[model samples]
Target chain A: MKNLFLIGLCIATASASSMLAQDFSAGSTAKSWNLYPEKKAFFKAKVVDPLCTLTGSCPDNCSSGKRQLALLRLSDNVMVLPLKNSQAAFTGAANELQPFCGKDVEVDGLLIEDPELFARNLYQLQKIRIIGDTKWTKANRWTKDWRAANPDAKGKGAWFRRDPRVKAAIAKDGYTGLGLETDEAFIKEWFE
Target chain B: MFKTSILSCATAALAAFAGPLFASENGERITITGEAIDTWCYYSGVMGGPDAVVGAAHHTCALWCSAGGIPVGLLADDGTVYMVLKIEDDDHSNGGDTQMTIASHVITADGMLYKRDGINYLVVSKIIADLGITNLNHEDYGPVPSFAIPAPKP
Candidate 1:
């Protein structure tokens, strides 16, 4: 009887692990492969361009033109979804991570699971504090200056076209502008 | 009175489990009409803010984003955003970019709607593109490259 009880406990534990959202161990390239419970979770990582982070290629500063959100990448390279604030309703807090894009930051949020959301690493971002290291400060200043220069620019492509960094890329690399590789292409190459 | 209460409770439970595979609360299949917007931009309002026009004016940009693995959303006329999930296919023929080509174009989608944590999600079963709507100039960001697009068949 005791042995049967132990077996049952083991089975329960195994099932629980399957349901819990977990990181794809070190060196693994998977991003948010499953749903997470709606609870608090903390992570420290850099906010990278989702285009470059997920697909391994992009124009200078994510000029992909899609309204893609910034994604958080842990030190070990685990990707996390940074939630977005909506425009129609104009919530003051939606897409709060925009300013911190491409910078290292600490994030704590309720892990709300929604598979449809990119990265499947949904977090109801309770707090974000920038790391403010040398690398972060430089990138943060550039982003601020870029925004100041193009106050009316809203889309990635628009900003990309107007960006001096992107112009340098274009002058250096021509119309290809840092070469494009998208997530759809990655999935097709690997999974499909 | 006790018997009536038991019957009502039983019926409610039955309705929930016996409903269609992805039925909304009403146990009905729903069809929503709206502009297909990239989920990231709709929520973040990052590019052009939240009120940015998402139809033909932004079609190319939207397509580029949607094809890049960003989740596509159906921003309904009623101001509701339904995060769309593609029903998986074995051959992977109906990829995301195919859908984004119609970005910024108005279309009707038939699907089962689900509301979770105040967010709307739809398991889109069929998409009916309204080419007449696509042909019309709704708003403008700039010149949409004259890439030839075939109209949806009548």
Candidate 2:
């Protein structure tokens, strides 16, 4: 009887620890699906930078920050914005996607019903693997032309300073709606 | 052996039910004032009206749109949009209706804010309806409201 009791206690302790660990671990259902009824599924799609996909205009500096890439469903023109999980756990999915911009990849994640500004689906990326490649333009391809034609806004939302959408947004909201209003000193505290 | 089997089963059960408890890492406690809007319509720019923030004017449509899995958003006065998860708890299974009932109405809610993957979610603890006349656009658009933007002053 004593042996059995010990075993039961051991089991209870083990289960409790695992339950606690599972809650904090990456891909925790609680973290991904507790609020929204997100469904997990596998998807194969080509990754494209939002600006290039939307405006057919790729900026010269196609850094990760400037180029937010999302998956474009092949069958439908649906966009999937991948969300990052723990850096140590799920890895930085955004960084993983950067290299594969314009390449086809397979992603497994929880599909949120939430849509972006244009009804694009929001996908919480869990696992991603490149399936194939597509036409990838070299970075800074338009640097010379874009610079020559436009006045420099000096890295203050520089990528989109001249965009018509940005101009219209400024006209309506008084600001670019980007981080242009953020102080350079404040930005340095975090960056430098 | 029997004890080991029981332990395994208990552990499995605990893991299965432990999801909600760990889902959100509640950030700072905050009080935010905003209008509840259907994320789909607001983001898609097809709000079918001038304001995407649904109130009685767009309540019925908000209900239908949100019922289909679209997230409900709280567009705050500061221009910050928070994705509101549950009202208080998960008790109200018919969340679509509950959300639509408060659509476009200005609300001041106290909650724990959470940030996951660059997105901000507000795990609302308490919500207070601010039913001031200006706080609401009470023009109930009926069960199936038509989208009309009273033609721009042409």
Candidate 3:
């Protein structure tokens, strides 16, 4: 019975540690832009709507994900703006941090700072987990959210090409998007 | 005279490109004239080529993209792009009222420029002059993506 109790305690402790630990899968951008060796920051912060924090333009539930979100570091009360995520290309970290609005989370990311130039630093969030939660979540939700929002934009060579909005816009605005007159002139000069 | 202007522009471009090599720990203070652009579409090319994604043509789309949290970049006249960290008193890079108001407008900005990972990041302390949609590329490209301006409801 004593042996069984010890085994249970060990299992529980391991499970608890696993829950608290961070699992980070670095995105392509993070791997490329790790310029400052000493800038990687891990800390607890509350996810906030930067507009509200800076402008006092508080909205309900961070404007229901309409506005960009940020982290107000609990330790220093400084606002850290996570411009990019761990993703490839030029994706932003809005959707990834949106879910945790107003809640405290453990952020594992790079803090890009230039004290002489920028008074506020920028964050590239690689991974995050709720302060008391078990599993860490990678900051790569932009593409996933884009796909979910655009269901019929399928069979993509490039996502923009297959997008219905792009097709409609091109059809209405024409290739140059200048106006029908310019489009006609362009077509006449180039294609015809 | 034209040759001298071309040579001067080339020299400026070279200097901007080589900025990071000589950057101090305090960063370099410079004044740059550029269009405030939506960085995502400019780099992603989802809308169109770099040329097609600026000025009056891409103005509407730039506003939409900025509102959606894409960081705004200042595409300088010398063809250098600076990812704006903050502009004036606005804290957020994108989606700030200041950024939204200047979307696609060419303005002379005085700021401190920071270079990292071959990217130019600017924190604009003041905007000297707002040149209001000077590119006029829409006369050539329409709205690079066209869909930026929604069709009027039937």
Q: What are the per-residue Cα lDDT tens digits for candidate 1 across B1-154?
A: 5565455545544443332222234323688887777555554333543454365434444554443334567777677776554422211111234454445556687876754323455656677655422422322332123221212244
Error of 1 at B148 (Å): 18
lDDT, residue A29, candidate 3: 26
State the interface C-alpha RMSD of candidate 2.
18.3
**A38-150: candidate 1 lDDT, tens digit per residue:** 44555676766543433344445434222244444564354454443211121212235546667778665445544433224544454566765423221112234346755
Give the better candidate number (1 or 3) by lDDT: 3
Error in Å for residue B123 of model 2: 0.6
lDDT of residue B38 for candidate 2: 57
Give me the candidate number with maximum lDDT: 3
**Count: clashes, candidate 2:** 4
Q: List the residue pairs that clash in candidate 2.
A: A30-B23, A31-B23, A117-B43, B54-B104
Question: Could you tell which candidate, 1 or 3, scores higher by TM-score?
Answer: 3
Which digits, one per residue and each the tens of the lDDT, describe model 3 over residues B1-154?
A: 5565455545544454343333343558899999988765565444656788887677656755664467788888767778776677665653556786677778899987765433566768899999766787866876557554444454
What is the descending TM-score order? 3, 1, 2
Ranking by lDDT: 3, 2, 1
**Local distance difference test, per candidate?**
0.45, 0.48, 0.65
Highest-scoring model, TM-score = 3
By TM-score, is 1 or 2 better?
A: 1
Least well predicted 10-residue stretch by lDDT in candidate 3 chain A: A21-30
